[model samples]
Target: MNHDAYPDNYIRGILNSVKSIAMVGASPVNVRPSYFAFKYLAQRGYDMIPVNPGHVGKDLLGKPFVASLRDIGRPLDMIDIFRNSSHIMPVVEEALTLDPLPKVIWMQLGARDDAAAAKAEAAGIKVVMNRCPKIEYGRLSSEISWMGVNSRTLSSKRPPAPTQGMRLSINRMSVGGGDTAASDRAAKNKSEQS
Candidate 1:
């Protein structure tokens, strides 16, 4: 798979097939991009397990922050890397240790390791580098276009209405947990500003 030119079907296939994600290098801070990405992906229906040694035994958005991928104790379809590009090899190594290895290893924007990607791909794992799942979901699902972001592919036909009852959860343990309330509040504040 060419990381430089991923076709829509290839990207959509992975996103559609994945149900659970373990986000390594997740953060507790609200202003960080990882935090926002975690919240968005979770709300979009992916069971998000946040991995951060610094926040081990702590909770983020209702889900317990695991110290490492091995501690997740459940099957993860994908592992989204949020660390620096230089640090991806170790993360991929750890991911490869899992009994039922994740189907995909996604390196977030600005983070890419060709050697690590090749290793994972050799082991029969799909790899996506230098891309963000949240952004891809929005772009593929046309949600970004709704926000007036120029997504490049336009159509005269109206997009379908968004599904209702998709509220962000605040009590990290709730069905939609993790500082969701904070996200809601931030959204509300933004709406008020408008």
Candidate 2:
């Protein structure tokens, strides 16, 4: 896998496949990025476990904080590391100890340790560095785009939410494309400016 640039399909596949996520360094504070990311994913229906020793007894998004990944007491599909790059190795090492082993190890944006990623990859687990699953989920689902974020990627297919007004997900996406009218409008606008 190229750490520099990941294909949209690669990321979409992981987001669709993973049902459970353990976020290491998750914070109970509402203002923190980890807190926001955790909440967003939880709302998206992924089983989110907050892994932080500082607030072990406190409740995080209705789930008690777990001090470590091993305390999750169940298998995880992915582990989102929110710690600094220097601190990533220990987390990945612990992730490898899980009974069933997590399928993917994702290092948060600005957090990447090549050596640690190598180790995880060697163990047959997929590794994604310097990316946020929350942002990836939003971009792929068009949630960000709808909010004027210009995700750059567009799809004509209606979001397969299974219900009205719920966010899109790759799980139900059979095809990837753009809304041709929107695409043409944007292209024409750019040409006129030039």
Highest-scoring model, TM-score? 2
Which stretches of model 1 miss by more than 4 angstroms?
A: 154-158, 164-194
Best by lDDT: 2
Tens-place lDDT per residue, model 2, 1-194, is 76765667788888889989999999988999999999989888888899999998998979999999988888899999999989999999998888998999999987878789999999999999877898888876767766776564745766555554354665434233432346545544553454
lDDT of 1: 0.80
lDDT measured at residue 141 in model 2 versus the true structure, 0 to 100: 72
After best superposition, candidate 1 residue 165: deviation in angstroms?
5.8
* Backbone collision tally, model 1: 8
In model 2, which regions exceed 4 Å deviation?
Answer: 160-167, 171-194
| lDDT (Cα) of model 2 | 0.82
Q: Between which residue pairs do clashes occur in model 1?
A: 61-172, 61-177, 61-178, 61-179, 62-172, 62-173, 62-178, 172-178
